[model samples]
Target: MRHIVIRNLGPLAEADVFLNKINIIVGPQSAGKSCLLKTACFCNWVEKRIQLSQDTDAFKENGVFENKFLEFHKLYGYVKEDSYIEYENDSMKFSYSWKTKVFDFSWKEEGRWNYVCPKISYIPAERNIVAAIPNWFEVSMKNDNIRNFMKDWQEARSVMTEDMPILNLGVSYRYDKSNNMDKVTVGDGVVLDFTNTSSGLQSLIPLLVHLEFLYTKRFNTEQSKNILRIEEEGTLISIIWNYAKNKSHGEFNIEKVYSNFTEMKRTEVFLEEPEQNLFPPTQGVLAYRLMDWARGEKGGFLFVATHSPYMVTSFLEKDNENDISLFFNKESKDGRYVVSTATEKEVQELYDYSIDLFHNLESLG
Candidate 1:
């Protein structure tokens, strides 16, 4: 299990969360739902950087850490003088404070550090723009989240060999590599340009494409090991050399490190607004699909920040055997947001809110 504690960060006053395999955060706009998820993403990135460098002083300069982790996510502005964060998992522990400007990290055990480097992907809420304009990354966009998503979107499109179905939607998305175009195939043989598709699909396609691509690429143990071996050749060499030196000193078992590095990789995805431009039924289906991906034989972690009641309800109402946590964020009396586990009463509140919205719309008719 993983745990996170945040305080005085952005719109969030306090958030203490014990993360599960599948975690969902739901709240009104500006209630710190996305902030919580982004904070987690930043913490994970920090962990990865420290592991790769094998140095706690990897981010010796606070400016370097802020720019790479906080500024990249446009979260620097949210940091107050007293902002503080701490994250811990099976492998390592990380803590940082804005007031003190101190970053503290430690491995769980003496020598048995979990060497699995996660393959992480962040899907932004603005992903529809990536689908609408596949070349958007070429434009001058300062948002790192969307830009990163576009890169993955392009790669996913290039690798897709056949049409991929849209859940609960009677359409399949196809990419024409030769023509460098995207098309949507309807029920018969009719195909239309992707840009001419519905808004719902325009948003859903990018999310699904990247989700499927990353999962397939990361969950395949043999394939992922080979790819990582090639890409992290230098890092692996350094790690092995250090392990061998430590073994000669009778420090620890080198074989255990190699075993962990080779076999323990997991995929982590931070998805924003997964119910974007989707209908209620389609949102439910999407939730189910996402849950399945996290609960697959090859385990993965999914963290979603969403506003849709349908999306939250779908996940909450599922017959889940795996660990799943639903967090609800709301404004407290002190004008700060607090996040806590969703209770049955909170779930009913969401249902009532949805019904009130529908009734308000009915009055116009």
Candidate 2:
């Protein structure tokens, strides 16, 4: 995303962010970092899902286009007057026109990114809740961000059958073993279910599993390779929950046969607060892990929202050297949240001296 405009959405009176490949959003509480990230993600979803191929009739009819556009805004139940999100680049311009109460999508037929619509996933700060459960139904939340994150969490957790890498927690841990299920090796001879592991591991594992599964989907694997495929529901969540509930595991597969996706050309990941359950040193590791994996997988884009200095400073390290764009959200003098952009050099110098940072969005209320 290159250009972002938010009008009268919550604390964001009006703001703009010019994004880069590996974009980082840093902010104090209620600064609307997640708001911006989610808005961008939502617009991207529309750009991908509502392709021009099937929209000739829909576009011509005003009501038809408006109705079709409303389906994607289920997360935002109602839009107050003069509130909108606009994201654009050279090829296309996408905006939610509050006055019209519909999306204004303008695109060129030959835009390259349009063909290979990217996959967007969120790793929320509440991710530990996802890994804590062996199985769960589709959870609903009033907050669209958490709700969408849960949906992705469900899909990502579905395919784990093979024993994962053990999380060394100094002492062995165990849960009620059922059906000789998957386990993580923590010690020399100790094995335990993933849910019974430490909080840090729990939070990290689902994201790792989901991204790895997606990477495989784009590169290698199919329905025949899946450990369990539920053609009835057929969703990755359906199959994954079944495995979690019934104690069965095999290689998991998320095939195009089940989803609308053919294959991933690029991935767009939004990670919120990766430093939550991690130690100071581990924050850097997790940051690099996220950046390295996404870049290595298919030269994808990454958007991270963080409150940790370690997380911010990781990009300044020698290994990552200027491969990031930092968006800092702070309250303007008039007490409205406004976002500011910093190049790599600015971020490194500012963070290196002033390690004191503010709290995250969640902690504000």
Top lDDT model: 1
Q: Candidate 1, which ten residues in sequence have the lowest lDDT sum?
A: 356-365
C-alpha RMSD between model 2 and the true structure: 10.7
Q: Model 2 Cα displacement at 159 (Å)? A: 4.0
- RMSD of candidate 1 to true structure, Å: 5.0
Cα displacement (Å) at residue 359, model 1: 12
- Candidate 2, superposed: residue stretches over 4 Å from native: 52-80, 109-114, 138-158, 166-182, 216-218, 223-262, 318-321, 354-365
Counted clashes in each candidate structure: 0, 3
Instruction: Residues 1-365, candidate 2: write the lDDT tens digits.
Output: 46888876666667688777788888776777777776776666655544423233344445543344344334344345787778776557767666776656676634422345466776667766665756534444554455566666555445555543422334332222355233556767767676677787777666666666666543454433333322323343354345345434443333432233334466788877878777888787777777777667465778888878788777656335456787777676677677778755556555655374344322221
Cα lDDT for residue 23, candidate 2: 84
Candidate 1: segments with Cα more than 4 A from true spot: 110-112, 217-256, 259-264, 343-365
